[model samples]
Target chain A: MERKYWEEEIETMPRRQLEKLQVERLRKTVEIAMGSKFYAPIFRERGITPESINSVEDIKRFPFTTKNDLRSTYPFGIASVPLQKVIRLHSSSGTTGNPTVILHTRRDIDEWADAMARSMYATGLRDTDIIQNTSGYGMFTGGLGIQYAAERLGAMTVPAAAGNSLRQFKFIQDFGTTALHCIPSYATRLAAVFKEQGVDPRDTTVRIMIIGAEPHSEAQRQRIEELWGCKAYNNFGMSEMCGPGVAIECQEQNGMHIWEDNYIVEILDPVTLEPVPEGELGELVLTTLNREAMPLFRYRTRDLTRILPGECPCGRTHRRLQRFQGRSDDMMIVKGVNIFPIQIEKILMQFPELASDFLITLETVGDNDEMTVQVELAKATDDFQLLDNLRREIARRLKDEILLTPKVQLVGKGVIPQSDGKAVRVKDLRQNH
Target chain B: MKTIKQLSIFLENRQGSLKRILSALSDQNIEIQAASVADTNDYGILRLITSNQTKAAALLSDIGVLVNVNEVLAISIEDNVAAFSATISSLTDNGVVINYLYTFSKDGRLVLIVRPADMEKAELVASAQGFQLIQGWE
Candidate 1:
């Protein structure tokens, strides 16, 4: 075996020592945060300084940074370092408002690559492995993020940017690719193409699959695995947290190991804004502990997930995060009931008759708010009773999960619009009078 | 037992949904021999027998329509109240309950398309009563 750990000393650091490092970095982060124009005034108003942070728990003392805060600041508003020092920047698509920009210095970029390389290494990817990145480039972080990491890990990289499945397969075969990085939906779509081409994925050169960027249920992961004949690892990251490499699943394939050395993770009830019990689902809050150019303080990811209670057998002291349930921001309040799209996805995936594509639309009817779920059938059926039973079962299960019965619509395959990037699962047209 | 192919389409209960499927099939020169719609507030199931069942289905599928092709029993009945009643009563007397049925004319002759609870038995009963059966698209 060619060494188990990438940075063995740090990866296997004791819990007590990891906490000490977190506190030390937390203090440094506060000092660096003071340099930013966005946080300078807030810190000064509260009399918060580097000396104020004594432990990791002190992260709560700082105000929670929401997406709105990042929006109001706009481009270059949150940079702790000058523009000359920053070498690169990645931003989230702001369809409703200003897109949040994350500035990265040369050192910050190198650290990001290091974090990603460490993540890939944990998954047993080596220098000899040929990595194919299918994520979109340019504005999307998943592109360059994985590219740099694969190169950093000394692996051969094929930057075959998203779409053009024909070209993707060509590259995979030509380059003898061993691993693929893509979103969960794209993975399912590629599997369909594999079937159409009469080429079994197991017979192909690829063996490892890394999927992230979109929220997916455990059932979806299992379906991908079965289709690809390989292990589909769950990955978690956001553009605000420097894209992917923030957390990844090791060979154990249980939960994602968050890079505690680079981040301080906290799970809190989204509504109450208070810390929830460990191993319980709550909105994941992340604080960038190592980034130099733009370190975020208590950034509310709005993603709902729980921390696994036990230590991973992989021996990495970094805590594991259960696969995300859904984003808190994606929660829809219809008729006094809270429903998340992932909840609907989980129920739909249980049925082999339903395709992975689905859309949830909330509309206003007179004085009542109604929800309709449109899902595509995996395969056409000649029996009306089978379809009727599937639709009724979906509605019944949804009612139990969401406490509201949504009108379930079974659509034809390929009816739902497919986005090359993150999929839009919900459309709320409810007009509040 | 002889049977004809019938297309069961899932159509959303909204304006132009039916028109979209109809136009798509017509554009491909596929004729609708008989049609019946079972509808609810949300959506409808459009049962159609076409001149070219295979061609019509492929065309509808290309335009993103959910279609299910099923074999149904189509019997030619005389153009008279007594003949229609006697033909239907024969099947009922033989313990065959028609789940669904629709009618259309072929060369001035009445054709009754039926999906019964038991298709194999219904086809036998119709044939034993000396009724002419329309099998396949032709």
Candidate 2:
């Protein structure tokens, strides 16, 4: 059967017209961005203005905005609109430091809903399909952000939030939920739970699985599809822009198509901060073209992936991003929880018996991604009780910091392969995401 | 109250890894007194008592292997069913938690290797039970 789009004309818009629209929106975004208390002074000092960006290429002239910039502008410092105009705010887990906050007005939320509606539609989710959003709701954008989009698409949405696997299964079977949105790792875990109950995933009415908010491999996507006997589509988005509707894979199952009208996508060498060659893997940089509350300019996403250099079979002119290869930074996504290497290092530094010569290993044991931290016992450390107790305490500290449990193993002094040069800290041996 | 030094070597679960570790020590003419491998899906801990643990660990480290030396309680008891039963009862009665226990035949002697949660309690129980306790065996 031929595929249908929710917004066919925009999805397959001509390249010339798409670029013109991007330039127009880019200029508008710059003007709105200047209203931000965070950017207004920068614009004045740097001699940057809306008139300065005559075309999309001129966007590069305006200095790049990094995650550090957002961190420094914590709270609503970066908001262009007044506090009264902002309707909602979502923040990332900031246990180690200040969390990145995203502010949105009513119009921004509606626009995000439209983008998410298209995201769901491209993956074969229609208004007739019942959607169960399993992403975390509160501070996380994945939960409520997509809920609005599904409702905007006229789909009966169940804001089931996260966890409660038994109730999740009941809602799926009882409501005949057709669209499933969640992290691939949790989906894998839930699939195993259902298997234990002797439930055949094919018997369920789930037809379209939108897996995103965490990077996963194509093999993982296929595994999820085989388990549920349904199509698993990949989506790409971050809280800095909107939510999970920035891009999504069509039924073609090629790469994720990022909407050009809402955001300008760029792949740049993280070190040099220059654009990479076509189809070359580099750090993904994005600019929010239509964000009224907080219009971001050249915000570095740190996600490393190449652009699939071709048109999609589903006929969406928007360029597609290849499967996430790895991150430019040392951000580790453990079971859908984002973790930084420094966080682990910082925790390890506090323990004296541990010499901090440790390696973080990511491996897939069955359907679950397990993080194992192999640390070295200090040379003079001979107290077995202290070592065992310290291991448990370190695990508790890590769980408190990252909100995920990790296997803490005490290895030999030289077991982790340290050297005079810069040592590799992470070893990812998992099949995919 | 003497203690036995047991070598705990970390081995990634793969074919011939155990054989490689065993052969590596044997190649050096180092004899493994008593050996056992506790395995998981990814890795294994090969625990062995050797007369030359310091040399064995040094040799393994030289060959880029990971090994640790831990002091454990090794007891020599009569090669009988009641001997093993009494051995456990002695420790459990004294509130000693047995982390793990394995036995092997060496020189016609039935030796029970025990790693306890409480080292002090284990040593005390073994002393009072009249079982000949060897610090660590070759």
Candidate 3:
């Protein structure tokens, strides 16, 4: 018989007991954070000692950490423990600026795996399952982070790190693979490959899919579920707080249950920097309570989501978070209209005639700014009227949402460049002029 | 029922897009018997009468180019203005409208490739007028 919970004791802990654990861990995290070169002076200036955190609410008094702090400190300044004690490090891509690094002790790596294991178990993956991880390994934590968790869950893991869709199918058939972990965009592209190769995904051994590392709409998730014939679960995690395991959706498939035993979750207005009303949309702020090598104190995640109100049918005391809307930094301003890429994605995915890939281009036309949305058609058609109608419908739907008409172009499949890495959805050409 | 198989390809209005499609077909040794490009500022459609369209469509699609196969009327006529006008008037006088038409000349023989708004009407009119309609390209 399958088990009800991964760690029933911790997962189903009472609310009062959970809050007590959070307070105790919060104090410990504050002390650990003070040991770092990055937080020592800041803690002194803010008069924040371990005793300053009486309860989880006291976390509001502590100074909020930003990405700029991580960048300014560079590679090792954020480590709470000595460099000699650290066993591993993961750094994100620094396309915009200096790469922010997260250091981990041997114990920290173990705990990260344990957390990820719990998340996988919540999605009904068991030791009997063969998990194939398709995320790239190395510095990208999704690769190693998920790999360790699958191993910790006692599942047979195939570390088929990223790309080479042909080999992925071979492993799925030959190994009798039962689960897959990959980003959402790559998941859709994989579906296309499955079609091109004439493989019926529903007939395969796969039953569960864990998709993350990019913001996707509910429509997109439903589309993936229909294509892969599996229960697609949304995973919410950032490298700052161990990747791929901080939160996960259970079989209920309602909202992602954030692991409260390991971290304190806070939702705050991005501009006001104050906590929003319960169940209101805001930026997610996190503080690590279990990490040893680097215990980030009130680190701002910049991701926009809301803590779902009320209890989940699954009965986990930990709070559930709605799927991330978009990053605060990812919002684009076009002619005084604020728009998130996910908003466009939500509308596009609703249409079955369209493919998963799209590119939003902002350009300067004469003295005016114009937006053009280039999306791919799922298949080629000789009917020009059908293509024209699709373009107009997409434009009309976008105008209804954004209040500005964008020039919508329906292009051929594979016209927009798709890479093994994250999909680049927006291109601002107005910067050139 | 007598119609020519034409491959209509979607091409983005950017540098090297047409070249990429042409090079892919060229590498496969696919002969392009006739070609016409309908262009706009953002994108264009390249229509072609190929020696082996089914093979050409499969090859181009495999290379990530969008190709659609459709049947368009191909009428053989004299390489003169009068012959061209007569063939077009035969369809228009029978209440059929031509959406688009492109011509190709080979060895003093002119062929008008017509994509009529109403294909059934155009096919009946061409057959009734005894116009030499090319069925499948050699």
Candidate 4:
């Protein structure tokens, strides 16, 4: 068989041997965590030591870290190493509020690049491929993360950093781009532009699509794959976990094989804070075992996903993660029923007539809370009967997905607004409306 | 039988969108001889038989409106009863399916713009019925 992994020894090592390495790394990581001022209190209170982590399971003793903690600490509060030693820093764009920052030393950068490279290899990218990167560069980790990995893999890199759809299409056609990396939302928007220009995405030179940085439903992913006529891999990561190299789908495309050797993955009950058994869904908690300058212990990523039960055919021993469902924080409870914006997005994708541009608004009038889904029709179809039929069908389908019938509002093309980076899917007016 | 070309501009159903398009056209000094809004709850298709086809299309497209030029038969008839119904009856008799029909009083006559299922059959029916099909709108 042809070589499959970037690091065969590490990627295909025996589970027992991998566990030994993980234990050793866990001990060192605890020491590294103790270096941080934020973790020092928890260490003293919990009586954590380098030897405190006797086995991998002992990591359960560590307390969880949160984005709010990172926010509270702000700049350099989580940094274990001195200020001068840190060479690079990446900050979350703070979709909710203020940005949470992460620092990386020279060694930390190499480790990050290695994780990204291994993931790129797992997704079947090669040095011979031409890569077009559309993620925003600077401050955000999406752009630089993939660019460095592609470059390290020796692929011809086109740093087409987001937006300017016309120019992006020009570059893709002109350069014969073989691989693309961007958020699923941006990729979906580009498909519309391709249709407008009479360009067939499937017939194009792009063979692989790397989608990450935002939560998307499986239906949305399938729509993008169908449009481009290429296989798309789901990438799972956050700014706290070195920005999108944490887990990625291998060629099997069943589940993402998270790099278990570098991090300890746990699915825990969000309320009880206890680990759920294999194949069950829960909040993803990650502990960075190999990162320097900053090390996280059980950082609550807020993303919801489950662990796949069986071993993958790809021969990688790392545990695989299911496609991220949605952010727990983004879920909206409507009239005693819980609904996710991605669930609404999946239902919207079922209708080809509706453009991908959409917004879900949650408002309360009187005593009841209503979720209003506003979307745009792909074409300016003025047939009143046809449009009325479409509206009714959308409401019916959405009601089927979420038990509560939504107030469906249809807009014209481009009326719901377009998302270039991470899509803003919800607007909550429960307090005011 | 001479058929004038019609321009269809896609407009969102929101308020002020049609006004914005009209202001853009008005700023360019374009004259509309006949116009109608084929609307739905979500969007509207504003059909126009302007004084100029190429100029109107270019003007709307420049203002970022999706504009498509189509061939539609415009009948210049007297403003009397059955003037519009007679033309509709002629097309129906000859198996010419009219997709949609809109009328506006222009040039001291009732101007009916007919979107037909088939152009050739509609023209044949109009010619056989002695209907005066204007080549282009005033």
Candidate 5:
């Protein structure tokens, strides 16, 4: 159930030893990237020699890869390895536009699974637990990535790829799923379904619920625990970054312990491209230290978070990162106040009378940005005044929580539309206004 | 007994816009007593009896939903008031503009529906000027 490499290097390595390993991996990755067709041009354009990059500190010399760079390269643009060696490819949700394609080799796949196994063990998941992976499978890395790790960890995995709430409930009851790997929002949705069906989620045998793919608040984490009657853990990783198990919340649940041996994480100011002080919020820049097929150097993740250095309470030497605040692109500025949709969502979920299905719309009325929270009512009632009460409660809550007043709307059940892939929780219609 | 105010809101026919209107009211703590929707191809009429009618109209107006207060009476009687002249005469004699009207009863109470030209003035007159307004079951 233990990964030998991770155990030997990550858990035991001292600060000096880990840095030495990172420098060695960084040097090798640079040499490999320089010889490849994709990264050779980037290196040549920057007028940097592969031999010049000897240590991890030399990573700053290379230009950071952004999502735009990935798109411009298009298809197999930034891939350092040959197409023949690439066994699998995972793409982003392309929510912003085109999906960023990520290629993986057999070795790379094994490393990913190993890293996930370490993450699972770090979070207290055992082989005896039946892991139900509710993340989407097909093109998304969530389902396949977690599925491999669960299997690798000797845990029985139910590859229940998202949706079908009823069947998922039946599987959890019938199969006795002790661990759940899915988004926190879906976990809450399932809890709601159980309530509507007159079933108690607390009475079930689910022990741990692993949530990822979306940013969630502490309030949300507590709510998920209250709903499922299980400890909810958060993992932070993107499809491009090797999916959910890149960093996992240990038993302490304070912060996600980053696998420093595989990935060198740096908190950098998004505008200045300079390193921020520890515990300060900045964009997460990651350098894949050991990625053979595609080793990214200082890849701009655009994920806002702070890095917490030191040994974890779980006895791991790797640095942990604070929970992702929100994506830089998703941060909405209304009336000179910065607002995150997750913040509003956390507030809404606090009310038992409210459903999880809600939408936040930002419209620019004149020069000011106006926000409208469209929440779906669970049932049909003749009480229109109850709707008014809910609206005022939301407005009051938003004013207290976000320091902004937004118009609240209560719609009929199933009135708000649903999305296929990752749910489109917020719609920015400011440009139209 | 405190009098409750009923509002007839005119909503445009669009995709999922009604929900937005209702969410606004629900957030404001205006409890709806009884409600019904009359829909056409162009627009829909949302009829609502709320515990706090003044607050509901103001909240709806702030959110850009056209709503107006109507002074209706809930009297304990059998059958609907077939004579419209009596209802109109009661308000018309007091310099009230009869904009539109509807009537329904609940729990053996006869409800008389009346909409004045100016909802604010109508509500003020109904409350302060001794116009009999409907109250839900005690």
Candidate 6:
């Protein structure tokens, strides 16, 4: 087993050495951005100087790059490198609005693969493991990104793409897949299929199941483990910040460890844009330390999370990030109370009967914004009254868990639509006046 | 006094999952009058018409299915080949593109489930053409 790059660096370098590396990388990144046509004007207009930003502390002098900025510069506006130098491009879902395109050079691709390899190592995925990649491919980075890393880490890669559960199950059985990478919801569905097929996931050779893309709760993780009989790992990343390997849960199953050597992460107040105190919930902001093609300075990810600044039990010195709370955009104000759909999902998935597939409907009932949770029950038993009992149970759970009384409508299995790529969990029906 | 209610139910792409809801309704003795399924790789929308709309909705809700009830005009025809083509021509003549259509029968009535480009215009054209537009809830 090869020691991770960060692990090696932390063990060898003193605090000063890491600080120096960050300063050097930051300086070079700023200079590259200043020379670029896209960012030069913005920085010049803001009266910022690359020379003034000599250290990590001087990072505050730079302007923040947002999703709107990426959208405004759509297609190929933010390309710091020439069009010929760029090798590949990835994009956001754009379901909320216009998709943001991320361009990567060959070097960027190598770094991304390295980062993912680090993540794989952190999860104890060995070279001997037959890693199955189930994330959606093409334009989306999840499948390809993880594939490159798994291959780089010496793990035999199974590029399953997405969908075709029957084929996926066959691969798991025949290929002797030890590690799996996919969305948490899909992982749950796979487990359900395993149960329905009467296959024991525990008895199988599968070891680590890595899940990402969506914010999954601890309860959901436990359920997946119970169903699959494997240890489930949570992964966190976005297309803008490179892909699912930006952060990963170590074998300890503590918070996901962020690769601070390559990227600097901060939690800030969504409104104020000021760094929040440690342990306080805030929007996550990131700046790439060594990205050449598209280096983002103070990029607002819109994902809300806290930084757990400490050394991990796994001996990795890189800073760890808590699981994402919710997105700034997904936050709903119901009767002046701010609620995130992930919060509701976490509460609902605690029940064994309820599947991760649920819908949050927000509509204007009377003068106020009314919220309803339409939960999809997994399976139907011989007892019909169990349906009513499940609804009441969900209602009671929501009341007790989230402290909000939401109208619980038990939706039939398959009633809630699924997505091969990004799962659209919350349906906000409130008209924007 | 018999009327049929059309419903659009969104479904996730999972095997044998739709059977749960359909079985629930079947257990209540409610029969599906007409049905069609439009599917993508990840999700499907099951469009249905039942003998009893209120009972279907209640049974579906009780079993925890998100059912959206839609009112669609089911035109009773003679089941002749000309009758079906004439219905299509009539809508085309009125500049209405049929969004979706399905044919089925109940009792002696040969029903054409017509979803036209314009609901109001389709209603007017059907009424003007002397075809009885099914109205009210079952």
TM-score of chain B of each: 0.96, 0.93, 0.96, 0.92, 0.55, 0.88
Q: Top DockQ: which candidate number?
A: 3
Off by over 4 Å in 4: A95-97, A330-433, B1-138
Candidate 6 per-residue lDDT, tens place, B1-138, comes to 222467766565667767976888788888887888776454456788876888787777676665667667788887778987887788789887777788887567678887765677877777788886566435
Ranking by lDDT: 3, 1, 4, 2, 6, 5
Pairs that collide in candidate 1 are: none
- For candidate 2, chain B by itself scores a TM value of 0.93
lDDT of 3 at A424: 76
Runs in model 2 lying further than 4 Å from the true structure: A1-3, A331-433, B1-138
Query: For model 5 chain B, where is the 10-residue window of minimal lDDT?
Result: B74-83
| TM-score (C-alpha, index-matched) for candidate 1 | 0.64
Q: How much is the lDDT of residue A268 in candidate 2? A: 89
TM-score: model 6, chain A: 0.78
Interface RMSD of each: 2.5, 5.4, 1.7, 3.4, 9.9, 10.2
In model 6 chain A, the worst 10-residue window by lDDT is: A378-387
- Cα lDDT for residue A45, model 6? 82
Q: How many pairs collide in each candidate, listed in order?
A: 0, 3, 0, 0, 23, 4
DockQ (model 5, Cα)? 0.04
Query: Whole-model Cα lDDT per candidate?
Result: 0.87, 0.83, 0.88, 0.83, 0.76, 0.78
- Chain A vs. true chain A, TM-score per candidate? 0.81, 0.77, 0.79, 0.78, 0.76, 0.78
- C-alpha TM-score for every candidate: 0.64, 0.61, 0.62, 0.61, 0.60, 0.61
Per-residue lDDT, model 5, residue A363, is 91
lDDT of 1 by residue, A317-390 (tens): 99999987778887788998777676788788889988788998889999899898999886665566777899
Error of 2 at A26 (Å): 0.9
Q: Using lDDT as the measure, which candidate wins?
A: 3
Query: Weakest 10 consecutive residues, lDDT, candidate 5 chain A?
Result: A377-386
